[model samples]
Target chain A: MARVVFTANLHRHIDCPLQTAPGRSVRAVLEHVFAAQPRLRSYILDDQDRVRKHVAIYVNGERITDRERLSDWIDDDDELFVFQALSGG
Target chain B: MSDRLLVGTKKGLFELRRNHADWSIAASHFLGDPISMLLADPRDGTLYAAEALGHFGVKLQRSRDDGKSWQEIPAPAFPKSDTDGLSVSYLFCLETAGADRPGWLWCGTIPGALFLSKDHGESWTLNQALWDLPERKDWMGGGFDDAGVASICVDPRNSTQVTIGVSTGGVWRSGDDGASWHAASEGMHAEYYPPPRNHAPEVQDIHRLVQCPAAPDSLWVQHHNGVFRSTDGARSWQEVTTIRPAKFGFAAAVHPHDPDTAWFVPGVKDECRLPVDARLAVARTRDGARSFEVLTKGLPQQHAYDLVYRHALSVDATGTRLAMGSTTGHLWITEDGGDAWSLEAGHMPPISCVRFG
Candidate 1:
């Protein structure tokens, strides 16, 4: 299971706490996270189900490369961090 | 009369209360957020405010006990398809479907799509019939980067008879709810285009479309170029060339009881979007569009550069109480029609919409 964490700024709009989920890719990890907190989906992705331009997801301190498909590979012991791009807010 | 006013602004949603002599700010909600549209539902006094956040996209909030508290509701979204993927950039308008259909709501959104919420904003469905029309392919952006639903006029006589105005696209009418629809008319002319192409309905840019509740057949529009009046239910529109000051404006409010009486905020055209002579005045006509009377009493007459948006001017059910908000962050109200408008608030933020309840 990979550890997932969201920025503290998003806590006011939707609750997102540190958690561990089993996934091998960024897309699967987000799907596991959104499956529990449904309302958080739109805030992270747009209508096309792609990552919002202003939001960034990092895998163990490395920025995810693919925003459209979010196919960046993840390891079981890796850490995922979601942050709202400063330029957007 | 509705003494409560809801103003959507660039920063937040401001609620104001009317006093014996003037209006004053009572409460503020969604501070530091851009409120795009508001609806004070007269059916059951339900208040709705739409916030367009730059970072997190659009959000909808509803308050039943005035402005005391709000509940987050799901905003309308476009369905995903491989052929064409569209998203709602912003909510342009929120309108009620007459008093009879108390729970029904009509929403106009950017990308020129319409959505219907039967459960009072709790859930919304995109109007697919409207998007499927062939005329939509010709739709273009007016002032926005893409085409948007500028105004929605639901027929008072029948809730199903809806007439929608798109910013760059022409007007569309639906008779049997959302089952079928058609281009309202080929009557309006587009000065931006050349020759016969200017007369095409798809090229028309309608700024705002408003209909008189008492006389549902009478419709008035503040077009991109000028003013137009339609007495035959938008089947045909006759250009009104007699408006004083200037015919270019973005907002128009019709009296609830009188079809002939209407109010419009006029300013200079095209290149210059400021008020004429840098003075703010509302043009009122009691006998249709034959003539207009500039109402400047209690309003700034010099060094004022306020421009009202499409949904910023609203007339309450009494027809005497009217509220107007401007792009320059000013709010005004009139209790005796449009004769004298008293300044309520200023220096707040740019206003997008106003609703009285």
Candidate 2:
């Protein structure tokens, strides 16, 4: 099982509370979480099922590289953090 | 039904209730969200708000209890495009099919796409017939990169017959419930485009469109070139060349019960999208487009630089009340048709649209 947490800013619009789901990869973990909060998937991923340009996902202090596939492996004790990248002046 | 106004703005959604002789803000929902469009279904009193988040993309929220509470639903999005760099910039229009077709809704989005939802706002599917049209390849955006569907008119007499106005793609009609479409910009002109190209079928830029309920076949359009009216369900358009103040504006409000009666807020032109001499007024036409009367009582007569968007001007079903919101965050309403007006709200976020229900 892996723990997933959404940023406070994202939580303002959606209730993406701490979620624990069983999965071996980031994509599977996200799929499990999205099943519970379906609306959150749109805010994180675009129509092409790819991570949004401004959205960032990290697994245990390391950022995921596969934005399209989201195939990064994770362990049962891993923690995933999803937050929007801050930009603009 | 109680009189209420749903105002979508750059920051949030504001609800205004008619209080006897005056209007008051009842409540504000979706605080700090850019509401691109809003629709209040008279069939079920359901309220739909389209929010365009800068960081997260588009979102749709629905309220069944007259906007007291809202539930986020699936937002309309384009199918994964492997060739075209397509993305929904924002939802530009939200419309119901008709009284005969309950729970049926139509949504127009940027990048030029149409979506239909048979279950109200719960789900939506892209209308591929309009998407796969050959003219879509030539449809370019007016201000942005890609064109957008800004207005939709569903024929009350026949739900299957519908018309849509694209920003730079001209008007299209679907007689088989969006299964197929054909360009309906026969007599519309595009003075902004170069010669020959200006006469092209799919090159006319439309700012807004209004259909007369009294005559379903009659439709009025505020084109980028001029004001036009179609007597045969948008099959052909005739320019209303008599409209004062250059006939260049985005908003058009038609009378609910009279096909000949309509209103417009004319600006200078494309280069100067403001009232002539900075004087604000609402032009009303009682005899179709034969003539127009400029109404300025209680409106700014000098130094008023306001630009009304396409959906910002609306007339209620009763054909008596008219409301408009400007890009400068000023709202005005006319309870007695267009004879007089009063400022209802000011200093708020830039208004995206105003709907009276």
Against the native complex, each candidate's DockQ, computed on alpha carbons, is 0.67, 0.55
lDDT of 2 by residue, B1-357 (tens): 238998999889999998888898899998888999999898998999999887788999999988888988888887886764466778999999888989999999998999999998788899999989998888888866789999999988888989999999999999999999999999987988888888787898888988997898889999887899999888889999888866999999888789999999999988989989999988889998899999998889999999898899989988888889998999999888889999999887889899986
Second chain TM-score, each model: 0.98, 0.98
* Quality class of the docking in candidate 2, CAPRI style: medium
| TM-score of model number 2, chain B | 0.98
Which 10-residue window in model 2 chain B sums to the lowest lDDT?
B80-89
TM-score of every model?
Answer: 0.96, 0.93
Clashing residue pairs in all predictions, respectively, total 0, 0
**Pairs in steric clash, model 2:** none
Which regions of candidate 2 deviate over 4 angstroms? A1-3, A20-25, A58-65, A71-79, A87-89, B81-85
Candidate 2, residue B229: the lDDT equals 97
Candidate 1 docking band: medium
Model 1 earns a TM-score of 0.96
Instruction: List interface RMSDs for the candidates, in order.
Output: 1.2, 1.5
